[model samples]
Target chain A: MTALLEVDDLTVGFERDGTRSAAVRGVSFEVAAGERVGIVGESGSGKSVTAQAVMRLLPLSAEVGGAVRFAGDDVLGYDAKRLAGWRGSDIAMVFQDPMSSLNPLLRIGTQLTEGLRRHRGLSKPAAREEAARLLRTVGIADAERRLRDYPHSFSGGMRQRVCIAIAAACTPKLIIADEPTTALDVTVQAQVLDLMDELTDRHGTATVLISHDLGVVSSFCDRILIMYAGRVVEAGPADDIIARPAHPYTRALLDSIPRLHGELPRRLPAIPGSPPFGTVPADRCSFADRCPRVQDVCRTNDPALEPTATGRPAACFFPLDSVPVEVR
Target chain B: MSRFLLRRLPQALIVLFGVVTLAFLMTHVVPGDPARLIAGPNASAATVASIHHELGLDRSLGYQYWTYLRQAVQGDLGTSYALQGTSVASAIGHALPVSAAVAVLGVLWEVLLGVPIGIIAAYRPRGLLDRATTFGSLIGLSAPPFWLGLLLLYALAYKSSVFPLSGYSNPYINYLILPSFTLGLGGAAWYARLTRTNMLEALRSPYVQTARAKGMPESVILLRHCLRNVLSPLLTMLGMDLGYFLGGVVVIESVFGLPGVGKLTFDAIGTLDIPMITGAVLFAALFIVVMNLLVDLAYAAIDPRVRR
Candidate 1:
């Protein structure tokens, strides 16, 4: 079956100091219908840019090149009017910072019902009822009474729930929840994630869960894509990647995440250097300088995604499978 | 609304008090004696003293201030010293409508012409219209109002015979157009520059981008979203500009031989008409306070965030 959304060889670049540089280079992925996919990356790893490009929400100056097919429709060439019809209706998006994303001036009911009335041709009374139902679905109590309140009247978690309610208003085929719980308290974050998981499943909507927390993705996503330096360095079933990460960068990231039960004497492992700014250099492994196992060839030749002995892809010459059977 | 007025009422009283005190004291301290000016250059000493006594000018300064403040509160500005039996209040009443008419018409032109030009300039920066407005505003800002008024009178009124060179017409049936245009043109240029700069700054705000992302129509975004946000600062500029307009109109009214408050003030100063001078200052101060109050209320209404 065709995937719900397919982004092929996507590249997003910015013009800096009179030269064009890519922020996301040659990243490819797909989320099939009914499947949940997670993109795990730190800041400047191009995950958010890729997501924004799919929505055509980037600033006018940024240059993007790719094929983004949403339900067999090419999104790149659609004009403003057609694009507007797609956003918040066919492919609703919940933004990272729920605090600033919703307009403070508008009432919660107005925002949730606006897209429904525009896209679904629902009457005011019907739309208001649907909005209240959606709010309740997202676990917001007193949903009907709270509909008339503005965003400022809500707490941070409540506001994020309002955003989720708005996103799910149109019953979109896909919901891109970008770090939806990143800004909340730890307890609230877990509750929000659980609420979203339950709600999206009930609605039968495919979701692209973009987050940097591997634990969050492992608990929520069916598959995971580990991105680094504007490229997806490793991707596989979430269980397999967590059990045995193929890419050196992915392994380093996993080791860096602190655990609750284990008490290691030494501090967590650190990735030696940060991602390259603006764009990756033309002909070098992006992680060469930071990789402990870097070789002379790693500096001169860039690596492409190569399949491993395990059922996954890793972009390194020395795959984890070749490291040895017992040296983990 | 009541809260807003409560704050503004005290402000109005303070402004009126300060202007009345300063005007009364300054006019009294001037070199010319009002009695001699009102009577004649050759008046006897006894006649001058009696004139002072009769007018209550011989009273102590504090008593004079108290009496003036009380009478002003009752809307009874005392009779003019220059024109016996004619009250200062009546002279102000006659002069106010003309000055006010010119000011009202001038402000209309300023807002109508200025705001659109500012919007256009902001919408198309570095374009021909932007450059033209920038240059025009520079010229308008530097050119003295009195000189510009004379230039207009000379060129349009005299050389081309297109407008009246002097004299103001009551009811202004067929001939008031020229004076209104002259008074308003410079102010329009001033407001246009302010609006352009303010709008450009507002357009750079993140909310404007959010509005665009919502796929709102450009016209709706510009008028409803951008313009309203830009208006907060623009309203402040408008209030101060009104004061500048009033000040500038004084010279414009004088140059054109118009019988507005500027003319009356000038005549009062020449004849040392202390009562009329104080009345004019108090009127102007009250006028400014009322305009600023309206602007404050408007700011609160447009953006409730301001009220908070």
Candidate 2:
């Protein structure tokens, strides 16, 4: 069956000072209907850029080379009208910073009802009622009175709830939430995630959840894509990937995550080097410098992601546990 | 609102006092003598002394300052020294509407022409219109008001006869056009630059991106999301420009030969009308202070975040 969203060899580069620097190198993924896929990556992993590329929301200066097919339609090639119709109704997004994501000057109701009125062709009163209903679905009380309030009037958690409500307003086929819970408090984070899960469950919508937290993706997503330095280093079923990470970087990530029932460590374990500024250099394994199990061959050969003996795609030449695969 | 006003009342009074004090000091300490100018050159010493006593110039400096502040507050600006029997208030009252009309029309032209240009330039940065607006604003900002006024009068009024040459008209707006444009062109440059910069920033804000992702058209994103954010600063500039302009369009009024507060003060200064000069100064200062207060109040009304 055709996937709901197929991103094939998606590449994104930003132009600066008359030169192009790749932010998201060739990356591919797919989201089937009613499936939840989590993309796990640290900063500059190009995960956020991937989401933006799919939405066609990047700045004009960005050079994106990829095929993003949304339900058999060419999302990248859509004209202005078709693109507008696709963005909020067919595929919506929840941003990282809820405080900035909502317009300060507009009423919450106006922000919520805009998509409904525009995409669904619902009348004003009908849209208003739908907006109120959506707010209620997101666990916000007194939706009627709160509709008139500006964003400043809402608290941080409430603002995030409002953002979630807006994303789910049109009941889009796919929802791409980029680190939606990172900005919220720990307690609020679980609630927001649960709310998102509930909304997608009720609507039977596919979801692409992006985060830097491995635990977040592992607990929530059916399939997990572990991205590092603008490339998906490892991708497989959430359980198998978490149980035995194929790539050395994923192994390091799993080790870094603190356990609730283990011997308490004096300090949290941290990876030694920072991620490369833009895209990792093309000649060698991107994570070789930071990899704990680095071999001399890793420095000379670039690794392409290919399915392993264990039947999972991993980019490293010498993946974890299994024997080394011969490089061409 | 009441709280805001209460907070501002003392500030207003202090500003008014400072303005009155400055006017009094400048008028008293300046080289020219009001009594000497009022009395004829051929008049005897006795006549000049009597004129000084009548005008309260004979009183102690402190007493005179006290009387000046008191009288100003009670709507009593002393009789003019130049036009003998003309009250300073009535003279100003007569000339104020002309300057005000020019100011209103001039600012109208400014917002009408400047804001849209700013928006268009910002909508497509590095476009031809943006380059033209940048060059135009630099010229407008640098051009001397008198030179521009004279140029307009010479070109549009004198040379082409599109407008009447140097006179007030019956409906008033027709003759006011050349002078108003002269005033507006300079201010329009400022507003355009201010709006363009602010609009550019607002357009780049995350809210604009959010609006775009909502499936709304570019027009809606630009207007409803970006422009509304730019409005507060634009309105602030508008209020301030309006206040300063309303205080007096001195050079424009003079070039057009319209009798305005600026012209009245110019005539009063040349004739050494001390009371008239002081009255005009106080009026101008008061207008600025009041307009600033109104703007602060209006800002809260529009931008709710400020209230927090």
Q: What is the lDDT of candidate 2?
A: 0.87
* Candidate 1 chain B lowest-lDDT run of ten: B206-215
* Docking model 2 quality class: high
Off by over 4 Å in 2: A322-328, B40-42
Q: What is the DockQ of candidate 2?
A: 0.80
Residue B207 local lDDT, model 2: 78
**Which prediction has the highest TM-score against the true structure?**
2
Residue by residue across B22-68, what tens digits does model 2's lDDT show? 89899889997777777778888999999899988999989999988
lDDT, candidate 2, residue A166? 87
For model 1 the TM-score comes to 0.85
Candidate 1: interface RMSD equals: 3.2
TM-score of chain A of 1: 0.96
Top candidate by lDDT = 2
Instruction: For residues A18-127, write the lDDT of model 2, one tens digit per residue.
Output: 77788888899999999999999899999999999998999888999989998888889999888888888988899999999899989999999989999899999999
